[model samples]
Target: MKTQTLNVGLVGYGMAGRTFHAPLIQAAPGLELTTVVSRDAERVRADLPDVEVLSRAPALFARPDIDLVVIATPNDTHFPLAKAALGAGKHVVVDKPFSITLSEARLLKSLADEGERLLSVFHNRRWDSDFLTLEALLQAGTLGRVVALESRFDRFRPEVTDRWREHHRPGGGIWYDLGPHLLDQARALFGMPKAILLELATSREGAEVDDDFLALLEYEGLRVTLQASSLVAAPTPRFAVHGTRGSYVKYGLDPQEAWLKAGRTPAPGWGEDPLPGCLTLRDGGEPELVSREHAGLPGDYPVYYAGIAEALLHGTPPPVSVDEALEVMTLLEAGLDSYRQGRWMKLKESNGLRKRLHAH
Candidate 1:
């Protein structure tokens, strides 16, 4: 069967939309960048000259040619914009932190189901070079029965800018902004944790929202730590996975976002990680560290859009499913509750709501 190209109407021209969504949508084979909703028309034209630009999201939603609506707006606007797009009979993709609240996420999912539209979140970090490498190591049993994992997304942004993410509002904090990436990756590796303990703080001098956070997710015999801070000046390992047989420690972030910001498209050797992870093993007796060059897998951000295109054009499932995102939302909320209560928040897997949602 011949596949129909999905026309994507991207809402927002900020970092997420311009740097990530636009380029990947154009790179994906079965997707077309049809329209964009941004107040800055010149900025949109500078990057995407041929793409139609609208000042308001409603204008893009009213257009009949847009088959898919990708919401890359600020954190607070995600739920409303996605709800509107789904209501307009368009498949929707909302960037991470699916919603500020779990109730909003549940409502969006219900709306998508009622409208028979595909709803997905842009959890693109699953394709990061370091993450992919870790996944391969775990699957190969290079790391046997993983017992502990540490995921960090630290930055040295000591000065708080006047951005929406820094404001004292719902979904405005380092946790909400960067937490989804770490939390989603953890949930993907290990299913929902038994409990979560979180510590949140405003470390920066002029920070209004949380600028630092540490969350511990507890499993039966495993403990996963997810952390992010804006005051870290020194280098830290992005991922540290330890198991009974071996350990994989990777230092450095994925290079795709930097490459995209520099106006470079995904090409040959695009997602190559210059700093490879070190694998230390003790399978037999003594622990020996092995250093291999370019051991990490190549990162591919375009794959998310490619899967979205395939899902909409054909009958395939979305790259990030609604239930998967819902699980992330649940964890996000649980972390916040843990922070507020100053204790561990237990997750009940056998609850009625979770059972009805069929979340794995």
Candidate 2:
């Protein structure tokens, strides 16, 4: 057992805080769910009976016992909460879509640097079973030199809810909601794209912001297209990769999120995906394409918090580095520019958005 524990104060007890952050922090070794900042103390207490629940973020931040502050609130509030957390001398973790804008993201980075505190964004999909399998395949040259890849995160919610995500506000859209996962996954696989083109739409009635989107990331020899929709009635392959050697198509989202939402903690078979991805490859001696099912490695969302604990307790680098988080933000902002300009937005050579945006 580890000798140290990082007491985490989660700033929101809303959907994200309750569904994702609280549970993950509780499960992480060397981390304690010390306090939660929420408007609904009853709800928080119903779930985490032992943990303290503060009525406001400032109250939580004032507590000297909190070693880490996790901002899992609404998208727009991420910046202020995280900034305050860092100012309070706490290691920080912000849920995805780090902030609404790249400038905000940079400011947060500067704060973390000045404070010498660990700061990371939660890009949990990196540990998805299918994505993990895909990464292994690419590393093993299973899909030799991938030329084109399509990643889709689709849902069938046609009705617009009154939630902050669906309302008209800065950072209130599907692009910010789901784009980070796809962008981070693409960056993980193919570094920075040479250029990017994005299209967004508000297709549903009563929708205030974009609910459907298609973004194309152009690489030197590869093209990665990321798509998400609110009205996707039929099923779509979650990922389809075409390469020089063969193609691998995987359907179904990683089961971890669903499992977590269903209130199941990590255990044996926790992250297993029932649907195996299929690989189509040319035979050794023939022109025929051989198809086979590829078993995916188990998904491991718990590893993210574990890594955070290790980084704080043992001085290892964070699993989701600030640079990586910035890269995702860079594309996110660039994608918006592409949508606005109706043209491809060019990116810097490498280390996507590590430098300031003036270079791009």
Candidate 3:
């Protein structure tokens, strides 16, 4: 197989840029980490000594050698940076929450279409081990028809930090931060929800943004709850699913992020599934406990870059398509509405504005 080398220009050297994008882009086989856009030239050089660190976003976009631009900047800059990259005739990959509003996402999608560029959103949680296992079990009917699913991403950060997350601003809350992961996973498992009931609040003392939230997704013969919190010290079941035939419970997080942070890439036991989730099912006389191990697939962040390369070079569809991301954004906006209205909000109705404006 023939492969082409793709020069990548990464914007922003923040936590997301340094920790996630840089490492993954360097690890990808068909991609080259050529240039980075960051004001902190010293830090960028220290971390990525070989790659040239450009000071401004436009400088990187102007480079003829760069084939792809990865945007890991703050929520507000996503739309503008992505638009500029696409307009510069470069492929773009924006981090989660795609943009602050559904309209911004729609606009970027339209702009990408007009410019004939490949655009993708980085919803890395879709590759999470526990999520992958649950998806497989559900697909194989091992859990028989899933009746209810509950997912939780809890933490213990009581005091508001110096980061932008603790502030009360657009895309400055737990919902916009962690909600994308849970909601994206839910939408992946069960399409769009008919209605969403949200209970969002600042449970932590002196916290401006919402530190906790619980969103209930209503589906046919299925009830899904997506939750997150910065106040819960002791987290509960990571994933719990109940089905007609049986139930599966897993109590651990995926190890990819931890391993990556630890600087242990390509090592043995990477992205390994922890263990078989305890299961309860009816065999013949009564319910029995079954311990079945789920197969572990390698967590490859490089796949995102590979998809971008394929899309830009060969005109193939991206890994996370714009339509799929738009669906997630719609649910996110609906969740916000549910939080404010103090009731369930239908996604279709709440997102009608964007849909009508971006109608085919």
Candidate 4:
């Protein structure tokens, strides 16, 4: 097959845009980071020297040569920017949380369908080393029939900055920021949960929005707990999974984000995680630590853009499908509702109109 190069227009220059999207998109086989829509021309030029920097998103959308528009802007701006991009007949990839609301995500999906453009979410954590390892263990039945899973994205940021993420807005919160990754990973591992119970708190002294959250996703015979906090000095197991046969406990996060922050390009050993997860087996109703050096599967963020390129050029499926992202959005909204009502929110009927709308 002839490789087709797709021109990508990135719509932000913030931490996410500069750190994750730009480098991954550039590293992808058939995608080119051609244009960036940011007010900081000097900063964009400094990182992406040959890329065109546009002051406005509309101008970038109007360009006939741009094949894909990746929205890495603030969470609230995701809906409008993606709507415009899809309307302009460009394939769109939005950063996590899909949108501020389920309605916005559904509308974007509708527009993408009408425009016949491929739409996907950047759930890059799906490719994380720890996650990949757990997924493999589950598939291999190493941990037979996982009954409980705990995932944490804890950090030690005691002070909340004045960024949009920390402001009291629709999309500003740790839940929206990190919840998508955790929720998506859970769903990927155990499919959709029957219900969700969420507890949110503004723990930091100066925090305007929620800086801590603990969500409980209930399955048939499984219980998944997802937690994130801005205050934590000690290390917590990134993933702790237990089942009938054994348990797998892992500490330390995947190294890709840190690597990207250090301005390192993806290459050999890019996603290799040095910290191995400890696996324990049940020995005649007694637990025995078998191996603490179980090698984690390598993480690969570049696979996301590479999948996008193949989807756009050769008719392959996207890395994260639109339907899967809509499911994540449903859980996000349910989490908020659960917190407000102080009860568990059921997801059985949540996919009503949106699922029908996407059926076509």
- CA RMSD for every model? 3.8, 4.0, 5.0, 4.5
lDDT head-to-head 1 vs 3, winner? 1
Backbone collisions counted per model: 0, 0, 0, 0
The whole-model lDDT of each prediction reads: 0.88, 0.90, 0.81, 0.90
* Clashing pairs for predicted structure model 4, backbone only: none
lDDT of 3 by residue, 35-150 (tens): 99998999999988999988999998888888889999888789889988888988789999899999999999999889877788999888877887777777667777777889
Off by over 4 Å in 3: 1-3, 284-298, 349-360
Candidate 2's C-alpha runs over 4 A off are: 1-3, 351-360
Winner on TM-score (3 vs 4): 4
- List model 4 lDDT by residue over 108-188, tens digit each: 999998888999999999999999998888877777777789999999999888899999888999999999999999888
Residue 151 lDDT (model 1): 95
Which ranges in model 4 have alpha carbons more than 4 Å from their true place? 1-3, 283-291, 349-360
Worst 10 residues of 4 by lDDT: 351-360
Rank candidates by TM-score, best first: 2, 4, 1, 3
234-345: candidate 2 lDDT, tens digit per residue: 9899999998888999999999889889999988777899999999999894889999998879999999999999999999989999988998999999999999999999
- Cα-lDDT of candidate 2: 0.90
Task: Kindly report which residue stretches of model 1 are placed more than 4 angstroms away from their true locations once superposed.
Answer: 1-3, 283-294, 350-360
